[model samples]
Target chain A: MADTSSPPALHFTGHRHLVERLVLSTLTGRPIRVTKIRSSSVTDPGLAPYEVSFLRLLEAVTNGSQIEFSYTGTALAYRPGLITGSAAGHGASIDGVLRHEIPASCTRGVSYFLLPLCLLAPFSKSPVNVLFTGPGVITSATPTGDVSVDTVRTAILPIYEQFGIMNKLEIRTTQRSNPGPGGKGGTGEVQLIFGHQVRLPKTVHLLNPGRVKSIRGVAYATGVSGANNARMIEAARGVLNPFVPDTRIFSENTAAGFVPAPERNNAAAKRKMGVGFGLSLVAETSTGVRFSADVAVPVEGGVPPEDIGRKCAFQLLEAVEKGGCVDVVAAFTALTLMAMGSEDVGRIQIGRDVLGSEDIVQLARDFKTFGLSGWGLRDAGEGSEDIIVSIVGRGVGNVGRKVA
Target chain B: MPSLAPLGKRKRPTEAPKSAPATKPAPGTKAAEPESDGDSDLQAIFKRAFEAKFAPLPFAPAADEGNHESAEEEDEDEDEWTGFDSESESESESVPAPVVVVHSTPSRALEIDKSELKAFLSSKPPTAAKPTPFPSSGPKPTPAEDEDSAANLKNDVALQRLLSESHLLSADRTSGALDPTGKNRHKALDLRLQALGAKGSLFKQEKMPMAHRKGIVRKGAERETKRRKEAKEAGIVLEVAQKAKGKSVGRRERAVDAPAVGRFRGGTLVLNSRDVASIEGPKFKSKGKGKRRR
Candidate 1:
């Protein structure tokens, strides 16, 4: 498969949108070469630890994937491979689950790796089963703008149901953690099982985002008092009950996770990490669309649970006030599936502010670079600020699933 | 207890003059009798009884006029009252004046449903729609609907019987009615038994002689062949003839109490090659020689 006749690699620069580029390259079976990744920075002028860890995860799930880095780690050349997900003898353990570990020095949340991996799971040849356990798995929201794992399960996963891939999808978190001191690492465990594989995602035309019918939430306190969860639930209800009376928040309190903090002489010393509380709110509309908000205490730990809960509630209100069928957090996943669907026009309504965000606009440019057609946009014509985006699918879906 | 009596009398005369001049004489007369322990004792007893049934009263000069009349009538009874009762009455009156009622409400403890907790907090994502609980017993059906349902059930059974019995009527259609007393009625009854899963026809002769059975089978085959030949000569298409099924060659199961090997007869057991082979069980096949090996 590594012959000279392979297509020329697409070129990209800068470290921004690196995950999106790699995901597109894998789905399209094309090779990518990214240069000048954090090249201007003096102390860290290359791909970060989390990025390298993500590349390592990509290699574990796929077969024949090649990754090459320069001396300074600025330039990278990645050749695509077949997504043989969790198949026996392909870096998967005896139970047919690929275990990916994040380093203790990594700062990003676990959702950073989970979101893109989910996009590739449905197109893989076999079912994707991955268990994420390590010291760096932060289950809560981080200061770097990543959502908590609860939002990923309650809000983002339900979006795949509309695309005809709903069976056997589950996300189990045996342990919960917030970011450790200095927002570096946490000890957490999470497992993702995506058993539904389809050749093409069904085209969707979702325009009407109905009124919010109910609201559900989770208030998690790790290594902290259970009263913090009660306080957060009360504060969040104070803001959300008047708008939607069917609000329920479940409380979860677990002991603080401990990691090995051994010194030169003491080999058995362990310190507690991820001691904080957070709230995750998901507002589901009558049409089954979901909008989510997350707020967690910083690692320095001065914020009260009331502030975190109120902030999360107001953030959920803002997400709903944006007025679209898809939330800004889930827009990328929805749009990517539409672009990879069968050869037909799939239309979805998105808020103007959501579409104007940096991540979604860059996603459009990346799709164009991959040789896909441009999107067609028009006003939703409901006296609102929503824009209906119509995308044409690539018709080349699930290259690994073609044999089946 | 007696120390506050003078103070009570002094304030009463001062407030009484403000309401009316008519009441001034009453309070002035009460003040003159301030040394009378009997009058103060009766007032203390009345105050305790009132406070027990209702709220404690503040200083009311108007009620003193009514109590003065009752005081004269109960003067004899007050003398018989014990000294311990008067002391306890004074103590009760002192506490109500300085008492404070603190209204403390307990915090509400929301009881989370166990089923709901299992549904939402489990590993799987929560289902989109909540399950609506079904009513244990539905409302009683109206009399009109009940009668209509019963009538429909009766018609359904009648229609089912007609569908199965209509073939019997078609065989003798010239009469245009049911033949209740003819051979066709017996045939219809046999068909009903077969429909109910009977093993075989009751009219079949199970113990006929072998020669008689062979002759009957030959006659039936000859009649079927004759009809097919005439139809072919007349150039009329006929239905295909069905082949007779061969007898099964499998062994019959023996009774449980019988011997496992050859049959026992005349006080001696008879053994055959087939029976001996059954006792020895199956032999293994040799791949090289294409033969069986024990």
Candidate 2:
């Protein structure tokens, strides 16, 4: 929409961190170009189904976006437009909800889309209302390492509250499902309503990785015996009770979801999908810092419920032992909000391991390419291995917001 | 007290002669060996008895020993007393070992409140309005305050019930009791449910003959007018009656594909005079007092 000179598109390579880069482009109203997206793989190359579905979702939410792919589907270019959320007469339906259907070929969990959508919601012109449904909507953790929807609600969303974006936020799971056979797809439904928007996120200094005071969790069994939930809770509590006596893990059980799978002769045929059990645990510190762990049964399904529970408990302890204000699961969100804050610098003390990961390293490189300032890091204190990262905002806040 | 009294009395008679070896050591020298042991034993008995009735002695009997010899002598005397003292003292010491067994509670007690669990597990993220109230922080309400709250709640509920069900309570109807009987009770419950935000009364008949429904409406209106007339005669003010709603004169819902201004009859479009007049231009009136222009 700009007739004047706009900045040239930032160049990148490979498909890694595609969602994060696209989100940054949308927020800053910049154009991005990338080459060699899984180009090395001969059998299957270019963007995956879930990634293309995410791009479609972005087009639905924003006003005047453009996306193009090369002939081989490797190279790509995207020019982002104003984020007009779920405004009526757009792709939104009568109820003001944008219905997005995931194809049955998708393997990644629904959280793969949800986490990035939340980062963009607070800067949109209006509220973001999306209803995710279809056979590919896996509500449980997938073997591909995507977390479950429950963890997103229990763990990641609370971090936004620290940034002063904490009103009218909700995630409603109408149907719960685990990954289907071979980790392919599941029939599930989820709705996300994010009504809070701001001119700019508030600056924050989360320096203290406080002591863990309580643990809360959810154990769910879909289309399986609810005794699986009991077994999982028993095993998880057996481990966590010694450390924090104030632990509570609630149990949820539901019937398996059904999707139409019509054969040649039978047109009304339907089959059950997403039948499994899983557990998600969240540990909240005294200062409201949250560390989360999630584990689900694989589609081949030989592992016992007790094993899943014990594995999740140990996972939570490992996250807590990393010793940071934000764990690896939530570090991206915290760091992004800090970099997108008002002009002042926001500081956060993160675990050395979490900061040294590939995702954060790539983000640092992408920031430099986007003409944003580099991060300033120093040791946290006397005995901590944590590095306190200080990020200065670009002072280019929400372009969609009209009010002060 | 009586049991210990008899035991002490029995021990005193045997101990009086045992002290004869310490002061007159010549004649009782042969007996002095056991008698010296018995004399120290008697000192221990008196120490225990004095400490039991009053405060303990500041100094121990072993403190009087000047060097290692007297300490050895005290140890030798104690070795002989365990074999020589009565059996009841040893029995009381052995009885306390079994009582020290440690008993632990269950590691996790799933004592969750139903409402709290439902709220936490609901679709929305649990609002951090209140953190999980640990069972350890359970506040103990005082009995006096509990009683006061209970009485106040009971009075409030009674007052609300009376206000909502006042019409059901009449002198001829069960002599002005708080609760009505049979059909009136059901009606009272329906009224309460409607007040609680139910869309309509549960007893409202959805299907009925048109004539019967109209008759009931007329009878209700007649009854209301009679009550208003009586109230007016007695010089008592009454609420104004609400006027009945008029029939709607708005546009009817039509199908999306239907023609706007014509009816399709037998594959032919027919428009009325008003529709045709609207399609044509409005005719301008000629001014009588001015020149008429083309």
Candidate 3:
């Protein structure tokens, strides 16, 4: 067992940073990027330009160091100048024109100028490339004068692709009304344009190496206690069954310890401390197997061996031992009968100071169905230590044959 | 022996046993003389009684005539009867005196004499006991005998007048000498007079003049009129004043601008235009035709 007596001081050195990065990467499945850094003081050597003050404070605390800090420095601000400004202006104008036009159309007739303004609002004040395919008379009126449609398309296509918004932009034109005091009439020609922009912020992504920290097993005589081993194995199986039913359990003996069933039972003379057994239960999904084992004697106080190795061996043996069976009837029947008649198995206590007589009687009757009988005992020691009986059973095999 | 001699001698001169002392009244010579005098006295008493029964008329007539003749004669006679002068027999001669007949029927005379004696006993000299003088009159009636006598006389006269007037009036009505309408008019007049008298007495006792009473009635009427005028004015003025005052007070209160103590007066806090513009970003501009700049 690992020493878990006192919490050790956490190291916030390079190793600690590596561990943190590893944990974060494993949890999020992505490289953690640091966008900016802020520091409280210029004199602190550990303070980096890109390190946040809170992270610095945490590192200081973990390193068991004192830091006298004052106000934090201002964070670096990113502004993309005319691109952001134009984009914001375009969005506002588009939203405003849409909001104004939709309601005005519903309330009155579609104004000729409003629709044209709504169409052109996204392109206004920004140098946006546009394509045109119209009557010769209409195409000749371009502001740049004499630009072909293919040239315009080529110019704007790369920009749209770079922003990853090529599918969102549409170039079209329609005739609609604009309503205001200066509106000329109900119809006018206007162009519609749409686009997006990409922003590369000041940030960096980093990755760290990873490795397994620990591996554990399900077994008795492994310092997990026989009962705890059984409970853990049961809980695991219980969880697996919802996703995969038709699971079964088996056991074998091995020098390593008790190996799961259908595996070659290997034993060495010097290492044979005692007879050993294992139980393996496979989920119906065949995706995994859960197993538990008990070794009568153990050479070391740890889990015997990995069930994965035994499972591989069991798969090979399963071919040769086709329909070869072990009789778990006696073991199962004994377990069932013991579960029925063994008083200790299901014995329940009507706890002292329980109020209703009827509840006590019902509890007693319920225990009786398990063939358990109980009498009140004073100073019975700790309730969980009181084991009144033990059960034993022979193994069983597939094809309903005994193998003991 | 001595006894025989005395018996013969005494028989001669013992005055015949004193002759039984004229037991029959000397039998003749007018044993009836005293009886006659008694009869004369009885006659005289009868005559005096008859004269007394008739004397008051002549006495009063003579007094009236004597008054016509002279106060001196009457005074003289009064003085004689009054016994003021013991020596004045001439005064009695000048007047016809009361007759006094003397006769011998002593019983009847005795009765008269008894009456005379009673009179004489009763009649002391007026000088000896003078009558009380009349009480002097003052603002208030005197409680003396004269006042009593006068009151009695007045009461008698009033009773007589009341009886006589009531009888005359009733008789006049019954006789039909006056017409029925006249009688009724008189009756009404009388009743009115009675009512007026009653009213007059009531007014006098209360010490109020008619004009003063009239003044009081007029003053009460004026007071009622003034009260109605004041009430009407007050009703109109109160409503208008209250309304005007209320409006003025309301205007003043609104104009003062100082927050009232209990009313919710602090205006709500609203974000200024710059703050809102900064927070929400710039407002979207419209692309309508721009206003012509001046």
Candidate 4:
């Protein structure tokens, strides 16, 4: 190897792409420096709490890492250490839960942090586990709805599943959290666990997302009129039923998880918090493609069930229209798995039209960060919109992972 | 710094600038040795670009020996190779033409074209107009010979084409003028006329190598369908039955182009019905008046 003694370093301006940078650095075992994070801002400017928490999680997972930051906190440097399963490097039994759970930072969706875990998990000796804290860790990208557990369950988990590690991985929400402006960050708790001793990840070949068969969803209401959940479901179904006659929308009254919203103490402090309620729906196709859309009650006045329902319905339809085995969000993750697969070439076929987005543009840039083999990525050229990406992996077996 | 500019500027919008080998995922094994320094010229250029953007830091240790060539190449070319060589994987596929799918729905069996026949019927003299219910064949499957032959071909001579008898309308002919409210048969006929008039272009078909184009997929077909399609003798010709007895004027055509429109109701069939004929009754002109040599 060129120089494991001192890794190559990269630099950047802000934390906008911080998560990607750090995750990439950790994976490549390269060092990097970042500068001018929120330097332009007069407010308590620096890396956001989410960015800091992500770094902390990375540090927790790896051993002998070196991290330095400027006193102003605007500039920082990181040298990644070896990524091992057991906190103790050599030999130890690995259990994610028994060790400790990295607290998922707020404002940032845990998927942002969890993604690196999924990428790194299979390679580690021990499975990775984390419990999210901060405000709104267990909520939807939508305003108020079911804990995002299902949304990601269908979207993110599939990445790990494609790697031959189905039972070894678990990402489930223990409690639902509602994101609110009044310091109640939904406080929903979710547990993510990666199993140790996963089977070697193999290349994946997913193609042809067939037509959508039906829509399954959850309409959740918490700390609000329980009827609001029903109303949201009714409204959403009304819009969706016209297009998809077989929609199964169930209502889950989620408010029981938290104490009554009266700021918990003085009954006089009770101001009507527009009940936290929303809908989460996933449209499944005959070809294993899943499209998810969420609509939650906003922080301010509640959205009429009609609007939320219609918007969510249309959003699902739009994602289906994009025509891929994976949606735009899931495309990058699935591509990453293929990027990290077996030693031989791997290919995946996706609807051609979806590749024209900016995500693919960013992905191209990101794909370059990983050193590829044989001039790495290639698209098997044909005259259709469906494409097959081929790559020969620099196989990432769980080489140096140690047990507790 | 990597140029903020897009990777492929000279490409059409549909061909996304994708497949750049960002960071190759770490394989389970060590990177292969660069036996010969004769790597791709494009690779050398981009290596330099990456080095300038992320030069090795001062305190950083030496570049990994395995990739020392890449690191060294970067430092050597830092002063040259300013032009951005996008890491786009395929030169031919980076910028694909916009996807223009033409659903060539084949022509359906005939139905009574009332509106087409109506305008002619109403315009004729009462004596000439025969207000008839469309021929009984109007609602039935066209009794055209080719369809009859197709029916004969099936072991049981099956009828009513299951596949969309409507051939896909090529993108160009789809926009051709056709009455929106008119019958599907008329639209089909209009499309046929457009195709016939625009024949040579469609005849010498060129099968595009989808993989050659950025977004074209070769999933249903094996990989490299484009290579086979491009090098093949003929392009894909959709299997469809010819227009049902299109050449033989059927009863439907007979009804629309009836003798009444051209001939006067009470006049002899031999009488000149041209607009130039003495409709002196209309303009009240002398029948023998010399043609005005304006």
Clash count for each candidate, listed in order shown? 0, 0, 31, 56
Please give, for residues A230-341, the per-residue lDDT of candidate 2 as tens digits: 9888888888888898889999999999999899999999999999999999998888889999999989999999889888988999989888889887888888888888
- Would you list the rank order by DockQ, best first? 2, 1, 4, 3
Q: Tell me the lDDT of candidate 1.
A: 0.83
DockQ, prediction 4: 0.00
Give the candidates in order of lDDT, highest first.
1, 2, 4, 3
* Cα-based lDDT at residue A1, candidate 3: 8
Q: Give model 2's docking category.
A: acceptable
Give native contacts recovered, as a fraction, per prediction.
0.39, 0.52, 0.00, 0.00
lDDT of 3 by residue, A1-404 (tens): 01234223222222112222322221112222222223333564332321232233122111121223224322221111111112223432433221111211111122111112212222223323222111111111111121211112222222223212333343332321112111111121223243332221111110110111111121222212344334333433343333333222211111222211232554432221112222222111111111111112111223333332233224222311221111111111112222222123222211232212343344333333322333333322353222122322111101101110
lDDT of 1 by residue, A304-400 (tens): 8978988898999999999798888899899999999999999999999999989899999999998876999999996988999999999989988
Highest lDDT: give the candidate number. Answer: 1
Q: What is the lDDT of residue B245 in candidate 2?
A: 81
* TM-scores vs. true structure, each candidate: 0.66, 0.64, 0.11, 0.51
What global local distance difference test value does model 3 have?
0.27
Which of 1 and 2 is the better model by TM-score?
1
Better of 1 and 4 by DockQ: 1
Q: How accurate locally is residue B147 in candidate 3, as Cα lDDT from 0 to 100?
A: 86
As a whole number from 0 to 100, the lDDT of residue A39 in candidate 2 is 99
* Model 3: per-residue Cα lDDT at residue A229: 34
